[model samples]
Target: MSMQLNRKYITIVFTVAIIAFPIIIGFFMLNKVVDPEEIMITKTEVSPELITIQGGFGDSISKYHGYNISHHDHSLFIQIKGSKFPIRGDKDFNISFTNTYGDIAEIYLVGQDNAKRKIWPQP
Candidate 1:
């Protein structure tokens, strides 16, 4: 009978550990989800005929490949290029495009790892 009681205690502990393991791991993993090379928008300007965006990466410019911008359905997507052989030096971008994102509502800055952050219209 004591052996059965011990088994019950062991089963309970095992089940508790099984349920708690992912919660513990997920808590640790949440901290790592933020990218170290994420981009940050420092300034933005919107005019009647032009829209200007300026930002830079968290790391050195060499760590990145390049940048691109796309306008889609009232939103702007800034895509960061990933590089295997990166260039050396520091650089920031100031790009202007025709104010064509009619009724622009959102702007996204996409990292080299494909992670995205909304930069405009402060959320």
Candidate 2:
């Protein structure tokens, strides 16, 4: 009788752990910071007058607004505006800046969460 009780207890504990471990791990992973390279750039339009880049975070539950563009020498610093919310679906963005610098060798997309990624001249 004592052996049966101990076995039943152990089995119950193992079942609970199996069920709860994934839930705990998933919760932590959801809150983890997103890497910059994960930011996907889907489309880019480069012209002599304007530079337009369109992209979004797939499977991200964050709300993002317009971009803030700053040009320095041969690089363009583009930062997305907005914050993460308890929402669903992906967020897309359209950013355009004047092509006063002529030719851009590099482009960086900075997120509101401080994630920075290079989107142009992909290597």
Candidate 3:
């Protein structure tokens, strides 16, 4: 009888631990996934005249907004605000906008010139 009771106690403890472990892990994971702020923009237009960027993210320490332009495209416009560093062009020569919070967005442009043209016409 003593042996049976001990076995039952062990089984109960093990079952409770298994159930609690998963609940604890899931709680933390949900917090992490919900913590990151996200902003989405749809339908933006760019022309040679000016660049425009629009987005908002919560949290000052970890929030930013930017746009990405594709390689070798010159007809693209980019603008950003509230960023720690200046926007960088990608390897393909595309424009990229990033925020201070490490969020990045890109736009693809074509028929843009990245080449340096001569001021005077070639004779």
Tell me the alpha-carbon RMSD of every candidate. 11.5, 9.4, 15.7
Cα lDDT of model 2 by residue, 9-105, tens digit: 9999999999999777655444444445555678877777999987777556654444567788888877654435444324776767779888888
Per-model CA lDDT versus the true structure: 0.64, 0.69, 0.35
TM-score of predicted model 3?
0.29
Candidate 3, residue 12: the lDDT equals 100
Clashing pairs in 3: 64-99, 67-97, 68-106, 68-107, 69-94, 69-95, 70-94, 71-92, 71-94, 74-112
Instruction: Give me the candidate number with maximum TM-score.
Output: 2
- Point out the higher-scoring one by lDDT: 2 or 3: 2
User: Comparing candidate 2 with candidate 3, which one achieves the higher TM-score?
Assistant: 2
- State model 3's lDDT: 0.35
Q: Pick the candidate with the highest lDDT.
A: 2
TM-score per candidate: 0.54, 0.56, 0.29
| Better model by lDDT: candidate 1 vs candidate 3 | 1
Candidate 1 segments whose C-alpha is farther than 4 A from its true place: 1-37, 61-66, 82-90, 112-114
Report residue 46 deviation for candidate 1 (angstroms).
2.3
Question: Candidates sorted by TM-score, descending order?
Answer: 2, 1, 3
